[model samples]
Target: MKIGYIRVSTAEQNTIRQEILLRDLGVDEIYIDKASGKSTDRPELKRMMEYVRYGDTVIVESISRFARNTKDLLELVDKLRQKEVEFVSKKEAIDTTTPTGVFMLTIFGAVAQLEREYILQRQNEGIAIAKSQGRYKGRKPIEHPDLKSTVVQWRAGEITATAAMKRLDMKPSTFYRKVKKF
Candidate 1:
């Protein structure tokens, strides 16, 4: 079986182009996600991986669609290899079933790592400069004034976690995350 995966950073982004391209490659199925590339907790991506069987192939528009960072991309490919699954990237024109493709992927992983490191370095430099100029301001904290009351109610056994989450209008993860920082 041949499966395709498509991903975009936001709900506003379109998956049509990627789907069309994957279809052209004769993919038997396509999985999609509207989430940031920076996040590893992609539910759709996890589902796609779980759906694959031995000798099944996974296709994507490019490495970027599969992963944002080199570590993630490399690790995912390694896992797929263990499953006897082949990975194909249309834009890269590389298929993991070939030795040459393995070589290319290694190089690509190195480049991606270097790119990530460079970006982090530049960000650090910019932060230092901004701090030196007394203009550095860290990210603003999430605020939900009603969250405190809801948390209190939940803690006091007046409400369930679900009730507190509903009252606060936040997802379970969001509620827990905010509660931790709140």
Candidate 2:
């Protein structure tokens, strides 16, 4: 079976292009993850890993969509190898079944990692420049009408932190961070 994996960094990003390409290539199954490729912790990725069998081929739109770093890329490919599964990256024309393909995979993985690093560096530089000009104020704080009351209840032990967070529709990190500011 030819299994396809498609990833986009955020939920808002579309996977249409990757899906179309994979479908055109006659992929038997596809797993799509609308999460950053910085880590292999995505739910869909985990499901796909468990679903694949020996002799199956895993295909991706590109190396970056599969992994953001060379280490992660190698580790993922190694895991696939252990299962006797092959890997193919469409854009890079890489096939793990060949020796030259393995060599090229390493080089391309390194280049992808370098590209991501450069992108981050450039983003940080842009943010710094904007900050110096007083144009980068960061994200606006989230406000809820019942936030104060919720915090008071939480502090007085009238409600659990989890309950307060749910009432405020806030995540644990956000709730704790906001509470710290009180």
**How close is every model to the real structure, measured as TM-score?**
0.72, 0.97
On a 0 to 100 scale, what is the lDDT of residue 63 in model 1? 81
Off by over 4 Å in 2: none
Off by over 4 Å in 1: 36-40, 69-71, 134-136, 145-157, 160-162, 170-182
- Which ten-residue region of model 1 has the weakest summed lDDT? 108-117
Which lDDT tens digits does candidate 2 get at residues 66-123? Answer: 9999999999999999999999999999999999999999999999999999999999
For all candidates in order, the CA lDDT equals: 0.87, 0.96
lDDT for each residue of candidate 1 in 90-144, tens digit (9 for 90 to 100):
8878789889998887777667667767988999999999989989988876577
Clashes of 1: 0
Cα RMSD of all models vs. native, in order, equals 3.7, 1.0
Whole-model lDDT, model 2: 0.96
Q: Please name the candidate that would achieve the greatest lDDT relative to the true structure.
A: 2
